[model samples]
Target chain A: MAMVLYELCGIDEELRFSPYCWRVRYALAHKGLTAETRPWYFTDKEALAFSGSDKVPVLVDGDQAIADSYEILRYLDRSYPEAPLLGDGMAESRARFFKHYAERSLAPAMLRTIIMDLLNAIHPKDRDYFRETREKRFGRALEEFHSPAKGLAQLDAALEPLRGQLKESDFIDGAAPAAADYLVFGSFMWARVVSSADLVSNADPVYGWLERMLDLHDGLGRSAMRVTDVEGAYR
Target chain B: MAMVLYELCGIDEELRFSPYCWRVRYALAHKGLTAETRPWYFTDKEALAFSGSDKVPVLVDGDQAIADSYEILRYLDRSYPEAPLLGDGMAESRARFFKHYAERSLAPAMLRTIIMDLLNAIHPKDRDYFRETREKRFGRALEEFHSPAKGLAQLDAALEPLRGQLKESDFIDGAAPAAADYLVFGSFMWARVVSSADLVSNADPVYGWLERMLDLHDGLGRSAMRVTDVEGAYR
Candidate 1:
């Protein structure tokens, strides 16, 4: 029984753009596991109904299904017990902090910065569903929420902690990339795939770390299909 | 030789309030080690000159003098090895993230919120030096920076990451309060000891975690002499 991963994709199925999905993708690659990735769209709710989740990045292993990215990552480590995402109990706990930090701080700022770009990059079928749901959640029109200056400032401020951490170490989880690195790299991957705007500058230590992340697992992230050729903008 | 810790204090020598100092204080207690705390003020640069850094929380372990809270915490764990501050390398790396997060995000927001209170709480002898250096750093008059509403909003936003993590675990470092927990708790201790303003609300998970932190090491934080009696305000 092969493992299957449902990944959120753009107009081109090869362009997997969801940050949460990217986390699982990176985690699987880090653990040296490959899964049959099924491109999922925002409107493809019926397809995921079997997993009891209306979300992408849902992992279906032989007899078990994991909905959340964190859950899927934890499941992979526990089930495989080889090439662990979390090194130990204490490391696992600390990784949780980075995961939450990315979720609560980094991703939201990135979302604000590239919400429109993200909508444009997604399949045309997902456009209305994406805009409507996102606008409703934000309680503002899609256009109104797009403030590049404010979003960039917030994103820069949010990156400060990660920047400080990266300055001291090559990766968030120390010598090697771990669950913590993937948790944050997912956000950068989301921006890279959809937005033309450069989120981080070349001088920032985070940019160097991002380059290292892109080089991980045989250039997994660097080779990913992007909607725009804005990688040069960051450099 | 007995360990000696130089802590930053206010007009009343008992009012130990520096956030960095509090991290070392908590680290010492967490390691089940007691140090003879010597109160150091901003004007007393000569007092710390021997240590080669004009900073509080300088841990004098026998003949070795360790400056900086992070260094002190790492030294304690390395030298003592029993009741370790950092559990493992990966955990230590992650704890470094929390330490950096608190230093980069939490402390700056907190400093904004309580700058005036901090000025009022410091020793009269250190007032001129404190105001001069702090004003120079902020690039404004101390009075001009006092916007309670803005400061509170910034502080609340800064705490979102920690609040999210606390919702999932008992402490920042997971099941137990470790260096990560102390790193964040130190900032709260700074607010608790000096400012009468309640930085975090009771409804916040961070508030509960702060309460638990106050209860740790046989009420070490709870029993500390505070310049203001606003600990009840958080409750």
Candidate 2:
């Protein structure tokens, strides 16, 4: 195969929900490339060991399997060159500002809102691994810290900086959606796919942006399998 | 005058400490432009009336007067076109991400740590106006909300994303300081000038960035007057 991508999925392999994978997914579409996506569960770290990172979103292109979504995105920009992932002038460094903002702020805020929904959606074989790893990372049991309401509020407050920009521009990257937009879109995709938390109210600009994001790539995000379709997603 | 910037000052006209004004000051230095900075106090709202703004950091270049620090920064880029304040391509929009992060996150976190000190350093004549307006905005008297320790911790948390970036790059913009650097530096300058709270420990990456910022423009920040010298500054 010329290119292949490893993704994390749920009880049903179609329900891909990892935010990091979503970033790479959107980036590939942006670059106009196609890769056969292989759904992998959390229990299969050995499958990803070839890429030197026991994480999903590993892109195998030809002889090289690049691990890490950011690394893959950079590799795409380097190899493709036609469709750029980062910007010119000061965009690369400035974009890192948004990267960290989304990673440190948005992911934490959105994850709390949807962690339980995510746990119930992952494959049965991956449940304990997910729970154990996440609980250890959070230092508490999943049920003990699931505050959907508080999480939604933090997501709102955490989005103020992006909200200010979306008010004036269509995308975070001005008229066009680029890496920065995809960086943040991944989190909202995770929240939307795994839960019914109503993360952002309809009145919010973020909601409108989310809608636009779903509409991008010929409605790729809107077509993703949601918690409602999965058998064990708290139904 | 070719150019003049209206700035908020303290008991001494030289103790310029408004974070917004500091952005414009640093931006001016970045572009290698010279502007006569006029010290304005909080009591004199009428002095800025002609500019259609009740704020500091209003820039008047030749016949045109622009209010708001952001507008002034953009104005510099448009007019000067050399040593651009914002980046090219995706840089402009991406840079705004850092701009708002600094404005909404860093400013608030840093402010709570130094609010009381700020009151003590502002021109004694402007004290009542500053206290009344600020206390009303904050929904309490300054003393009621002065939790310096908690404030410092919050500031520390707020700097996490910046710290992550500074770990790899010398400047947030990479090698050269730009508008984004000034965006965050303004708040730090506010903390350092108006208070002795030691906002960041000496070992912090942010502290090193601050020291480097003070070294810029022939130590412009280092040369500014501080709360230590003023008799009424909580001595």
Clashing pairs in 2: none
Native-to-model Cα distance after best TM-score fit, residue B139 in candidate 1, in Å: 1.8
Q: Tens digits of per-residue lDDT for model 1 on B190-225?
A: 988888788888999988998999999999899998
| Pairs clashing within candidate 1 | none
Please give me the DockQ of candidate 1 compared with the native complex: 0.72
Chain A TM-score relative to the true structure, per candidate: 0.94, 0.96
Model 2 chain B — which ten-residue stretch has the worst lDDT? B152-161
Clashes of each: 0, 0
Q: Candidate 1: list runs displaced more than 4 Å.
A: A229-235, B229-235
Q: For candidate 2, what is the lDDT?
A: 0.84
Per-prediction CA RMSD (Å): 3.4, 2.1
